[model samples]
Target: MNKYVLSLLCVSSMSFAATPFIYHDFDEAMQIRNYPKAFALTNRILNYDGKQFFELGRSLYNQYNPSVLPSRSEPIIPKHIHQIWIGGPLPEVFKKYIDTWKQMHPDWGYTLWTDENVRELFPLHNQSYYDESEGMGVKSDLLKWEIIYRFGGVYVDVDYECLQPLDELHHLYDFYTAYQPLDAFFVQLGAALYAAHPEHLILKHCIETIQDDWHHKGAPKKSGPCHFSKSFMAVAGENGSRDIAFPSFYFYPLGSKERVLRRSQWVREGAYAIHHWAMSWMPINTRRQEFRTFENERSSKVWND
Candidate 1:
């Protein structure tokens, strides 16, 4: 076994042990809108005491006073589709899936950015900075914001299989993202498949917040879903009518029991794009093996039925 794989397994073990406590504390913090407490809980779960978590909480608290509604002008059709792969080309199965999307939308531009290219596009001040065991994954999360902010478009994770053209959905909102429900109380707005016009305030807020709080213990908590959810909620509030938020069935349908039980039926009914839950933060070798196994299982189930 590779040293990196061993390290990741150890981290995974630790995470499994800590998950219950993390969930309890996070639920409590989010209930009262105590972002500082939430951040502290995340740090404890991840077993690190860094300045990034506290700083992120403070920055968000100061930045979240949205007194005015964002301008709802005519929506612009985003032209670019951005995907990031830091290690190398995507696996053959994923590439084929992306190609199907390209064939469906020939006019749309696709850009696959690598690690060096991402760093060149968005330079970090501290070259030695690292976040979590999967540092590159954190960088990938940050890169998505910079790329989308610079050139307005949809940023999709490569693992997501695009089932149809997003042109119609693109015209519906100036900015949009789907929900990944954490529990009954918390609905985390996902970053996997989102579209926005250049310089959208919510996207701007996400980018700025990540930049200020770049060095946290956990990437997902600091700059991934948690950060995006908080920033979005701050600007959009709890009002469902304010922004275009898709139900989980549209973007993240794989994890649900209903979807797993009625896989084919669910796939045919909705789901413009399906997130594979690639678990990209794991070691590359581990994730690649898991991806292959998952794809095989899904394909067998979906096709055989």
Candidate 2:
């Protein structure tokens, strides 16, 4: 009994003759544009008996998407930004990007979680996992979900440069994701920048699965994009319906060769952020040619002090 599939109108009045009367009432409600009543009638299909949603539904992994229902009334994700710096000092270029986020949204709350603070802020078990993770990327990925889930705000990678203020997005969605430029089967969600309300099911599934399903050797496959992408779509409806996503073209203009071999003029114009592709975790042999360290002069865009 997939309650979500129940027709838009199926409320019962306990009589065969009640069908026509119900339709008449429904028509009147629609004519009056009473969306609240229409929604209530639809929710009746679930016959909710006050059981916790976790116990009632088989899995929220298939709930309204991009990953969760849009926040049309009041935003669920707070107007805060969370970033991680679990290692040493940030590079000058990275710091510049962080400042841009503040310049763009000075009133929004900002949190920079460092190694010392994360241990105090996060649970002991999480500290163990963070301590054991191989690289900065892995450690950051682990905290990205937990911190955002615990605090309900936008978690952004320190390397991501903000081109625009993210305040407007808060008005429309409880969960939002950034996508890679391309995918073989489904939308490839980038972990670099995303917003969510605390205890969001998608984030919950990610946190729970990372511990059990973590067999991969790399961060992307372990807890980064590859892992998060599968969890994201599995919990979302087909093709990420009802969910909000900013495509790669709008986030990572110079995507890796695998995706947007090169960015088009239009793509650059539309981009709201830039991921400077600082692949510090890659081995010397594995690192891509273009991921220069911040020392080499940057080909800057939308950069602010």
Provide the overall lDDT of each model, using Cα atoms, as 2-decimal numbers.
Answer: 0.54, 0.56
Task: Kindly list the per-residue Cα lDDT of model 1 for residues 44-69, writing each as its tens digit.
Answer: 55334323433333333233312223
Whole-structure CA lDDT of model 1: 0.54
Q: What TM-score does each of the candidates earn?
A: 0.62, 0.64
- Model 1 clashing residue pairs (backbone): none
Please give the range of 10 consecutive residues that has the lowest summed lDDT in model 1.
Answer: 17-26
CA displacement after TM-score superposition, residue 30 of candidate 1 (Å): 18
TM-score, candidate number 1:
0.62
lDDT string for model 2 (215-262, tens) is: 666676677876776566557433333344454455655554343333
In model 1, where do residues sit more than 4 Å from their true spots?
Answer: 1-75, 124-134, 181-186, 211-215, 237-242, 256-264, 283-305
